[model samples]
Target chain A: MNRQELVNLIREKQSYLCVGLDTDIHKIPKHLLSHPDPIFAFNKAIIDATRDLCVAYKINTAFYECMGIRGWESLQRTVDYIPSGIFTIADAKRGDIGNTATQYAKTFFETYRFDAVTVAPYMGKDSVEPFLAFSEKWAIVLGLTSNEGSKDFQMQRVGEGYLYEKVLKTTMEWGTPDNLMFVIGATQTAQLGEIRKLVPHHFFLVPGVGAQGGSLKDISAVAMNADCGLLVNASRAVIYAGNGEDFAQDARRAAQEYQQEMAAYLAEKLAVKQ
Target chain B: MNRQELVNLIREKQSYLCVGLDTDIHKIPKHLLSHPDPIFAFNKAIIDATRDLCVAYKINTAFYECMGIRGWESLQRTVDYIPSGIFTIADAKRGDIGNTATQYAKTFFETYRFDAVTVAPYMGKDSVEPFLAFSEKWAIVLGLTSNEGSKDFQMQRVGEGYLYEKVLKTTMEWGTPDNLMFVIGATQTAQLGEIRKLVPHHFFLVPGVGAQGGSLKDISAVAMNADCGLLVNASRAVIYAGNGEDFAQDARRAAQEYQQEMAAYLAEKLAVKQ
Candidate 1:
């Protein structure tokens, strides 16, 4: 999960897809419910089906945490199950004061062993700096989120630019492209190019592509950098593609489609210096 | 708990003190390490000693989450161990996109049975609204943090006021006083009066009172309203007051001192309609 390694991942796979495992119990196939840990069994299937189709897996911690201790057990199993070569992200939007923030950093980076954990920048530098301290580990700070709530503060005027613009600019100073990335939503592709210009070298973990309805072609066209610095995440669109017994195969089909499309984008857009 | 219930608890106890359980294994007395669940054991002792001295207990989730599933077990036991009338807060500081935010709200409110969960407002209204959707549960949103990093985005100019000011103003619109509160850090007592004016009715969960160095006297003078609308939190200052065989007694003494000061404030400032 260093900068160079991520670059190599996209280049080697010809895909920058970061499949998001936002596995909710209520939404999963009923047959899997009888399994001791349905969340893990489902995730295991998804990872097995699509590991080669993507460069990374982003586990949305909220989904697991809702189930309480058992949910964490599921989360533990899922993170452990994901292959090491594929970069893993705990998309847990955690932020707090100094020492407490360090504990959160340890939760994801040390205990769960995720390559990166998404951080909220509202608390500012100290809340985020703890995540960047771990070598090769990453802190994907929220920039322009895909949700409707993004307009509430992110799009507001802050000095000369929008609040998210300030966030991207200010946060880059805290950590280099190696240990830091921004969660730039794909739904707001209008600002993607502007954001790309603002933080040229840093990777963007784009999360609005699939279920949230952002065209992958549009995002890949504008956002991909010389290093192929983009991790396009698809959560519900891929994982919940089908609810049948062959759900894993259905998920595989969806992932393969994304990978194939991303491969095309990689061919046209990626300009890695070999 | 509802606002009335919380107010009644404060009136009955004559203390707005929130004993923060930021229990770290390394910080706990070595004698407790022999226990099966040392974190829970330490927290039990502290709670047994100080349950009468405080109106609420804020479990800083980061401390428990760092230990993973076992850590969550400790959290479960500690929250369940607290007496029924005392308020419980999962100081998780979690925020995410809409549906995901609902999951976090469920994690803290439904699963954990916390009366309130601290939320970061960087994602805006939708992220915070779900936490308010619960009947009596509360969302304690971050307004002005205590750390030096608070100067970063929070203090920056946003239109006519600081970013944190806009956050306070805009976020209040999402939830009523019953289900919403703001974390107004105590160190910045200068802004307490101004923030009190901006957010008149809402309860403010004030940290930085003890270990982080904020005056309980100043915060109460400016921030206390008709309902004694403040929960002054002191984690390390109360929980880790001593590291010996009589640690619980020492914790009780520290908590008693805060409760004593708070009791006086409750008499002077708390002006209930009854």
Candidate 2:
């Protein structure tokens, strides 16, 4: 999905939740294990339960990749099953040399048909530029990540500012708000407002909200723009809310709760009408 | 393979050359496209011809990942085809949150069965440490990359030294030299000596030779340790040496050239008998 479509989605749904299918086979309800593809079955249920409540679906590629070829089949099915017009992100934190990045760009955008792919900016501009080349496809590069390890390099000072600050400022020069975005972890709410002001027009794919102990209210308060320039992701919180036969229903409840709260935030922050 | 096995392999072979199987479908000999699995067929020929010449085979996962499920099948087949003694690397460059990193480690080490997987260190210690969790497996984290874009973040000074240096030093606390390695690009010859001094025992997987314009002699002179701690990689130069019917033979000849140069460097730097 392009920038305008995504903004319209948040406006239309009054929610910017990107339900993550970071679906691990071991974590799913036991009853679904008998199915030919439990991962997809689980994801299908989650998508069905939450489709109307959210505007995006982010697939954690690692969860699928660890299963080998069968996992890929599950992934293919899951992506195909998601109702289109909603933004889709291949949360595959891929980065490499120039030519290699192009292949990754193809993997998510052309092959799997994700609307965006998460990229690591460690390899710098060329590593990220390939993902931005595709029209309507976005490259959501890592800014300040939620994990503690962000302190190791990203949070460290580079010249006058943090490495992530440098990342945000310099990376903005490479692409516009139309094709470029940043993955600003919800844990970095302290920096979120400044980050939003720093990169005013660009969107941010905000993870680390639900299961990772990040406050949804805090991040939304600081990061929302005129266009509701934030896609707050909640993975485990919604998908693994229940373990019984009513798991999908429980998931829907969890998603609706997030969407309801998000609607309130949208109305309060961007004056986005429900 | 563990550190000792890798060291012994380098010593026994009298070469630390890493044959990069960055097999691109469009670039492979058209005759091989008629095979049941063209990518695997091409990789098999290259492996058969260069088995004894190089101590490691680095598979650029992006090349295979772009082909979708069939690409993954080819990757499985090619890795299975490689001889047991040689180290195998999945040059995936994946990094994410702690749990996500664990899944990537499993993707390359457990599922794909590569001895080592290259990791991007942008997410910090939690991202890299999981790859080090597996016994006898390796996480070759990016220290400094070969691309011009490396100047963007990696070469930028952080605190007392470069960001990549902070990465090298801080990351050392998370894993032992036995399980840790760094991808030190050949283009950074000016820092090669200092980097070797900074990191004496750990191995460096050097890319950017040949097609990327890196000097084998320059890196070998400054970076070689007592154990000859370098696995210099030449991907396209070795894989696409010739695109005709005799491509494998051409590839073997290219690998032999790198091996021969590496053998001379091993003898000169480490004073090991070849």
Candidate 3:
């Protein structure tokens, strides 16, 4: 999953949206809740419905983990459901000691077959380097998060620049933009320019746009690089749009709207490139 | 599970040791590898041998995750095998958006019944606070990691302190020391004095002391507070001590050595207090 290939996928699909599979059995439609495997059933329909509208699928492992064994099965099934061409993310937030991280890379890359796994760079290089060692795999390190706590550490003034800026500058040495990306919160629209200055070429997996009150237009305008360099993820705003039997269809409709918006953003980007 | 209770337990056991159950089925003894569930069998023996010696068990999720369903089952069984008095940690370094973080909290605290879980604080407060919200449960945020990469971001100069110092100072307000702990790499013995200044009251779960070449004596001297405020974790150096059939006994011996060293550290702390 190189930068050029990701950009090409977005251009080919005319969409930069990444639908998040944060599916919970209890949160799905009541009619399907009685199904033997509600989480997988919901994920299957969601993927089927929105597969054409998006370029990627982000699976948050926490929702599936709550159901224990059943949740894990749902995760494996959902990963299998997603098309190979589309980027698949295991939003596992994994980072550990070097050897431990090597094992984690093997689990997400070999055992589960995810294209990328979200990594926390707080542990520095050893925790993140193992993930980058794998071919075609990415280490999406957290930059400025959209949460209220973003002010706690990421935005705190560290030396001359913000802590996140320092992280971006230092971690750049670990891997190239091709094998590394940054998770810049969509809500931190004001910081995008500063973030871009730190890592101008790297892809930013921008979350907090839909349900978390971040504007897509603001994010796209401020963050996009020469490449259509953003995978704006909308989880609850898409998947849980309607908790009734039409949940999947509603999800598709929400995804289509995001895709349509992304198409315009990328089109403007291409127009600039031309 | 509360603060004082945990402190008392650490005192009564005369051990601040937390044996990390980073059990890889492939790394287990050949005799156990032939069992119906190798990881579980190995873990069960380890638990049986060391339950009385250690006050806590830290289950690093990656080892279990690699085994898939059977690994998860082993994790659950391992959690069950530990006696009620000991603390349990799902060393699953999880952090995400608010809603998703709530699910992670539910999974580890509610589903798996873990007393604590490691979290990467890079995503800011929202990613970590949800984990901290649970009563008696902990969010062990990564402070100074024991890896080559620690030189990258964590140790980077930020203001008058390091970036990790900022993380410790800022995030400390989000949760009380009772429910908040920091993962200070045992290898960073020299910086423990400064780290102690930043997070004096909170418990520190220090790793990298054994196979990673960190000094236990140095860590205890600089990091310990009034509460014997440290849980020194040794994974490979303890769990994988021997690959032969006597692996569990070897593990016990290694753990006993750590316990004895920790007892010496505690005695020093008591002397300092007196």
Candidate 4:
């Protein structure tokens, strides 16, 4: 999906929400447990319930993989089930040798039909560029993650700046804002201002709100780009809002809350653009 | 497999060779293309052909993933087919949020039953530490890659040393040598001496040796540790050595050449240890 279509979808729904379809079978409702494929069944219900509230869906492949082949089938079905207008991400953190990585790009973009894929930048541009080569698809590289252990390397002093900053500056050269986005976790709000200065024009997929205790208001304030700048994801809080049969309804309510909050951010973004 | 067992297997086969099972459907023999699952058939042939000659099997998930559900099934079967004594790697290059990575570790280690996984360290330790938490399983972190684009950020001078060097030093603390390893490309042999000094005790999974033109003799000279700490891999040169019906036989021959060279390295390693 193009950036403008994403912007318009957010405006039309008054929501900059991207629901993380990180469907773990054990966490899904008991009612879906009886279905031949519980994960996909739960995912379908959640998507149908929240589609009006969300503009994107982030499918983390690890949960599906934990279920093995059956889980992958569910993931494929879920990807196909999502409406064409919404953005789809194979939230696969993939990066490796170049030729090997080129095949990964092909797998997600051609085989799985994802609009974008999250990439790890430690191996540098070759690892990330293969994902960028696909026309109209996005490569969301990890910038500063929202985890306690980020201090180990991401925040360490590398050169004139922190390692994350060096990664941002160098990786920006491999792809333009149109195809390259950064994964700036919501908890790292203070660094958002500094990250924006490094690559101000690119979009960011911000996670760590809700269950992770990151403030939506703070992330929007500092990390917003001219294009409304973020897809704030809330996984457990939104998806497993209630584990009962009304899980879908509870998920919708949770998503609507984030959408309403994100609406205001997008409105501010539109005002600045005007 | 424990550290001593892995070392013993390496010596028994007279090889530190890790055959990359990057089984692309199109690259396999045409006879297997008609099978219900082509990827698995191809992997089974290659494994059965070269199992005795190699110490480990590196399964790159991308090639199998290009086939979607069927591809994942092949990946599962391939992992199952390899002998228990040999090291198995899910070359997924995965790293994400901590809880998410914990699930990934469960998928590869618990579900798929792999001995190790190649992880990207850009998101820092939280992205990688979860993978290291599992006992006996290893987390192979990205160091200096062999790709041309590696110069983009990995090789950039950062204060006193390169960014990758800082990654190596900082990430070393997350796990011990028994559970942690680094991916130092075989072509980057010039830096192996320095890398050896940085993480002298840990094992390294080195790719790019044969078709990528890396020298086995040189990497062994500079990167070998007291444990014979290396799993030098060659994908295309070994697997695609002959595209005809005798492809598997050619793969065995190619693997033998590397194994013969590695035997000398192991002997030298024994001398040094004594």
Candidate 5:
């Protein structure tokens, strides 16, 4: 999906909500276990339940990768099952040397058909540039992550600003607002406004809203741009909303609540712009 | 494998050589394409020919992931085909949140049975600590990469030291030398001596020996500890040594040359210690 198309989808839906499919087979309802591919079945139901409520779905590749070949199959099936026009993200934090990175670009973009794949910027521009080479596809580089480890290197002082600030500034030069995005944790709400000022036009895939204890209101308030340039992701809180056979229904409820909250945020932002 | 076991393997082989299986389907000998699984077939042939000379095999995950399910199958088979006691590395530069990192730890260490998996440290300690939790398994965090892009964040000055230096110092606290290693690219020979001083006991998986134009002698001169603490990797130069029917034989010849050079380095180091 192109920049204009994604922005239009977010506008039309009144929610830049991205439901993260960090599905764990063990966490799924027991009834679904008997099925050949429980992960895919669970994801299909969740997509069916919440497709209208969100603008994108982010599949955390680590969850599927643990199952070996079967897991890979489930990943392919899950991505295939999601409806088109809704942006897809392969949350595979992959990066390597130039040629090796091109192969990874082929894996996520060509083979898996994800609209974007999260990439680590530690290896720098060459590692990330391969993913940005694709038309309409995106390279969401790690900026200020939500995890405690984010302080290890990302928050360390680099020149005049933090390391992540350097990452955001330097990486933006490699790709435009159209193809490059940044994964700025929603937990870093204090920095969101400053980050927005840094890269105002580029979209931010903000993970850590639900189970990670980030406030949706706080993140959306500061981070949303003229195009509602933010994809607020919620994983565990939505997917495992209930553990019984009505898990999908419960997940839909959780998603609807987030969508409703996001809708209000979008409306308020639009009204302010007008 | 533990630190002692790896050191012993290097001593027994008289080489700290790591053969990289960066098998590209398009680049493989045309004759092998007739086989049902050419990637695995090519990997099998290469392993058979060079298993004794090299102490480890580092499978670059990108080449396999690009092929999708069949590629994953090939990755499994290739790892399984390697003889026991030869350390296997899934050169999958993966990192994410704590929970997600656990799943990745499971994917490479538990499911794939790799001895070590390279991890990008842009996300920090939580992203790395899970990989360290697995007994005898290795995390192999990226310290200084071989690519030109390494200069982007890694070479950026942070306080008194460079960014990669801070990465090395901070990440070292999360895991002992037994379960943790750092990828200090062979291309950065000038810094190897200093990096060795920073983390004297830890192993370094040094890539960019041949095709990327890194000097083996210079790296070994400064980086080699008493245990021969280096797994210098040469992928393209060694793996794609020939394009004809004798490709595997030619690969073996290329690997043998590297092993011979490494053995000489080890012998000199041992002599100096004595």
Candidate 6:
């Protein structure tokens, strides 16, 4: 999806929510285990239940990858099942040399048809530039991640600012806001405002909400731009809300609540811009 | 494989050569395309021909993933087909949060049973620790990459040293040389001696030999240690050496040349240590 199209979807849905499909086979409802493809079955229900409540679906590739070939089959089916116009993200965290990265771009963007794939910037510009080369497709580079490990190297002092700051600044020169976004953890709400100032036009995919204890209100308050340039992702807290037969219904309820909260945030932010 | 086992294999083979199975469908001989599983067929031939010439086989997962479910099947079969005691590497530059990284570790180590997997360190310690948690398995974290883009952030000044230097220093604290290694490109031969000083005990997986213009002689000169702490990888230059019926033979010939060159280096390094 392009920048304008994603912004329009945020406005149309009144929510910048990106539902993360970090669907683990072990965590899914036991009743579905008998099914041929349990992970896909579980994902089909979740997509059907909450497709309208969010603007995007971020599939964490690790969950599917753990299952091997069958997992990849489920991943292909899940991507095919999601309706178009809603942005899709392959949360693969993939990056390599230029040529190898091009193969990765083809894997996610061409084969799986995701709107964007999250990329690690440790290998630098060439590893990331391949994904951005695809038109309308996006490469969400890791910035200030929500995990405790983020302090290891990302927050290290680099020259006048943090390493992530250099990442955000130097990477922006490689691609425009149209084809690039940053994965800014919602847990880092304190730095959201400052991050916004650095790359005001680019979108931020915030993934630390809900189960990770990131506040939607705090993140949206400081991070949202005129176009509502934020994709607040909630994975476990929404999808695993229930373990019974009515799990999909429970997921819907959780998603609706987040959408409602996000709607209000959108209203306040949009009103301020006007 | 453990450090002792790997060191023993290096000595037994007298070559620290890692043959990269970056098997691409289009790149393989046309005759193999008619086979039910061309990729697996191609990989099996290459493995059978060069298995003795190299101590390790690094499967670049992107090529397999590009073909989707069938690609994954090929990957599973290829890994299963390799002879025992030869080290295996899943060159999948994957990393995420703690829980997610656990899934990745399981995917490569438990599900596929790879000896080691390459991981991107952008997310830091928690992202990388899960891979190290596996017994006898390895986490080859990206240090100084060979690509042109490595100059972007890796070489950037961070505190007293480069960002890659801090990565090498901090990441060493997470795991011992037994379970941890770093991906230091052969193109960065100038920094090999310095990097060896920082993490002398840990092994280094060096790529960018042939097809990428990295000299095997230059890399081994300064990088080899007491245990021959280096696994220099050559992908396209060896695997794609011939395009006809003699492709496997050609690949074997190419690998033999690298093995021969590496044998001399191993002898000199071992002699100096003795």
Q: Candidate 5: TM-score?
A: 0.99
lDDT of 4 by residue, B64-138 (tens): 777787788888888888988989998888888677898899999999999999888777767888988898898
* Candidate 5 structure quality by residue, lDDT tens digits, B138-159: 9999999888999999999999
Worst 10 residues of 2 chain A by lDDT: A265-274
Where does model 6 sit among the CAPRI classes?
Answer: high
Q: Over the stretch A1-274, how does candidate 5's per-residue lDDT look in tens digits?
A: 9999998898888888899999998899999999989999999999999999999999999999999999999999999999999999999999897889999999999999999999999999899999989988999999999988888888999989999999999999999999999999988899989999999999999999989999999998898889888999999989999999999999999999999999999899987764
Interface RMSD (Å) of candidate 6: 0.8
* Candidate fnat values, all: 0.87, 0.94, 0.81, 0.83, 0.98, 0.91
TM-score of every prediction relative to native: 0.99, 0.98, 0.95, 0.96, 0.99, 0.98
Q: Per-residue lDDT tens digits of candidate 3, residues A19-135?
A: 988887767788887778888888889999999999899999988888888889889988988888899988888888677888889888888899899888777878888999989
Error of 2 at B27 (Å): 0.3
Task: Tell me each candidate's RMSD, in Å, in order.
Answer: 1.1, 1.3, 2.0, 1.7, 1.0, 1.2
How well is each residue in A1-274 modelled by candidate 2, as lDDT tens digits?
Answer: 7788888889889999989999998999999999999999999999999999999999999999999999999999999999998899999989986789999999999999999999999989999999889999999999999988888889998878899999999999999999999999898788989998899989999999889988989998888888988899999999999999999999999999999999999988775443
| lDDT against true structure, model 4 | 0.86
Clashing pairs in 3: A125-B149, A159-B159
Better of 1 and 3 by DockQ: 1
How many clashes in each structure? 0, 0, 2, 0, 0, 0
Question: Could you give the CAPRI-style class of model 1?
Answer: high
**Candidate structures ordered by DockQ, highest first:** 5, 2, 6, 1, 3, 4
Report the C-alpha displacement of residue A43, candidate 5, in angstroms. 0.6
In the order shown, the candidates' DockQ scores are 0.88, 0.91, 0.72, 0.72, 0.93, 0.88
lDDT per residue as tens, model 2, B1-274: 8888999999888889898999999999999989999999999999999899999999999999999999999999999999998999999999987888999989999898999999999999889988989999999999998899999999999978998999999888889889999999898899989999999999999999999999999999999888888999988999899999999899999999988888888878776433
Relative to the unseen true structure, what is the C-alpha lDDT of residue A187 in candidate 6, on a scale of 0 to 100? 88
Worst 10 residues of 5 chain B by lDDT: B265-274
lDDT (10s digit) by residue, model 6, range A1-274:
7998998898889988899999988899999999999999999999999999999999999999998888889999999999999999999999887878999999999999999999999888889899989999999999999888888888988888999999999999999999999999988899989999999999999998999999999998898899999999999999999999999999999999999999999998898665
**Model 1 segments beyond 4 Å from truth?**
A271-274, B271-274
